[model samples]
Target: MLTRHFLALLFLLAFAPPGTCGPVKILMLGTSLTQGYGLPPGVEIPALLQAKLKAAGVDSKVINAGVSGDTSTDAASRLDWSLADHPDAAIVEVGSNDALRGIPPAETERSISTILAKLEAQHVPTLLLGMKAPRNLGSAYVRSFDAIYPRLAKRYGTMLYPFLLEGVVLNPKLNQADGMHPNPAGAKIIAEHIFPYAKALVRKARVRRTAK
Candidate 1:
């Protein structure tokens, strides 16, 4: 029985997923979503993403540079400071706050475009996570804001994840009491959905040296 148990344990560990190789710094710049407003410490989006990467044998060190309620303009102003870590790659999640605040789409586009340009200047690979305007914002606003992401992605030649809150938004069970931010479980789903893109960034990071 002891020998059988030992073999079973060995088999389990063989498939048990190895931790990160070293530490490939990945910066997550955004607002409450990345800040993990309603989630617990280890359950935040960045942390959860780190865990997912590690499970896939990636050594991702996700730096949470999120400041809740920060708009695209706000993120633009703080871009330099936020890049202090000199991450190998970045995931940009700003602009949603701007949309919520009813900022003009052109203004939002300009700020986000500038931000992407700065990252490109640093030679840091980036993944832009998009957000759609609420339907109540009206069709015109929706068209403008919704088009901002693809437009920016094209202009900057960066990878774009269509929507950040793909399967979680508006799902009460996946959201917290306020229904804006996600709960822990919801955070996990986000991490999973974004993992493929984030993993590509990791691979890019591995080949490239740290950003100056």
Candidate 2:
């Protein structure tokens, strides 16, 4: 009888569903930054974020859906396909490429808005990582570009990280040789900065999932 009970427990622990024993599933959506361009796949922000969340005692899985050079338009188009993987939550971090390519802030906003709407429709919670343009973009472009994230986060009721590259962008040592992407150290900084916010998003999503 004891042996049978132990075997049953082992099976339950091994094959239990997500809510039972394993971590929550979170989909991270973005561009090269999220994809860890110029760096190994596991060194990206999403993986580091997962590590941080685990450290914080929240069991969670962060799926990296970042594609190199993906613009807001690209992300919007791929939203459905990405969500088909059945992530419990999502973090959106596009628009940098759009800003870099000078793709018109209005178009970027529209794309992000569309993406958020689709995620919302699927009842997937989300976190938005906003991006800012270089001062060279001029005041008009800056205002338009910077407003897209907050506007969408508010409209969709999602958590927003004002600047995805907050502490890592300006640091030369943190950035890669190209000065566009972050090295592993820089990715760690980003993970640390975004960890709490991501944890909260995950916890909330878990609660909602449980309620349902």
Candidate 3:
């Protein structure tokens, strides 16, 4: 019986899909910021993150699922499709478009809540990246919108990066001509700030993968 079991294990290992026993897949689900917007292909946050991980000796595949102009509702609607990749973990950076479009904060909250719930159901470790509404929005609106991320993070027990554009939001050097999406330099800053949190998610993924 021991000999047969050992042989079975060997066979499974031999035929396992590439990367199955190696890097974990991390899905970056967000908007144009995550997609790189007008930035060049290799300068996007996902690509920068992949490079960061490699440099740090962490093996992982960062999948970019960002879509320009996608609101929180849009993200919620396509989450099932995103989950089809069976990501070991996720980093959610949505809601900016909702704020920009003046969508109700409650609606944004609901959509993001649904996203967190779905990810939790799948046992995928998640990192929620918060977005502050434009200050031009009334203080009340800003308060409500800003509160969504921490509240959802607490509720879902997920890691929370307070702001996706932290340290890169207003500076002209960091922003593109549109002053919305980050420039390559801005993207690099984002990747650096997000690296530690993402690394934590990778660790959690590994633990969960091992348990299974």
Candidate 4:
């Protein structure tokens, strides 16, 4: 009985609700990757991330704002609409469609930079996901496009995931039939890799809230 009570107390302390809002709200703003693409509902990165946070004793909410084939330009246009919820943080994953549609790398960078700037002005924490340029786009485009995320991250002091699908994109077994998005298993891999960083961000937010 003593041990049981002790464990319960520990659990309560570890998963204690944060002040005021009660739960950290995170917005995942990306493309099909955030939407879970080929996977069913609740199996996507957002859902998986929420579950991972819960298991880690972090109380948080993850909002999925992914649209298929969305480019940085599209995201920039929709940025205000997406901010309606006033999330505690956001994970930005644009540029894939920009690369696929042969949009100028400079254009992609400009749009994404604008997006980040607006979010930063609001003091919303952000995690940037970088995507590689398609090989066919040529080395010049690749260098220019691929460097966008890191550069923007440095400028904005945002956390960067390097490549959103680092472990799942190239693996045949992890992708869907169209070879663009991840299947359920692939989403799991993505969730596992990104979960830690996201949880840390949420916990840090909770700390800040408490300190205030």
Highest TM-score, which number? 3
RMSD to truth, every model: 7.8, 2.8, 3.4, 4.8
- Model 3 residue runs over 4 Å out of place are 1-20
Backbone clash pairs for candidate 2 read: none
Q: lDDT tens digits, residues 1-212, model 3?
A: 99999999999999865545878899999999999999998999999999999999999999999999999999999999999999999999999999999999999999999999999999999999999999999999999999999999999999999999999999999999999989999999999999999999999998888777
Candidate 3, RMSD to the unseen true structure = 3.4
lDDT for model 4 comes to 0.86
**What order do you get sorting by TM-score, best first?**
3, 2, 4, 1
| Local distance difference test values of all predictions, in order | 0.89, 0.89, 0.94, 0.86
Please give, for residues 54-167, the per-residue lDDT of candidate 4 as tens digits. 998888889999998888988899889989987888889899999999999999999999999999987888888889987888999999999999999999999988988787
**lDDT-better candidate, 2 vs 3:** 3
Better of 2 and 4 by lDDT: 2
Considering lDDT, which of the candidate structures 1 and 3 is the better prediction for this target?
3
Candidate 1 residue-wise lDDT, 74-156, digit = tens:
99999899888778789999988888889999999999999999999988889999999988999999999999999999988
Identify the runs in model 2 with alpha carbons over 4 angstroms from their true place.
1-21
How high a TM-score does candidate 1 get?
0.87
Best model number under lDDT = 3
Residue 36 shift from truth in candidate 3, angstroms = 0.6
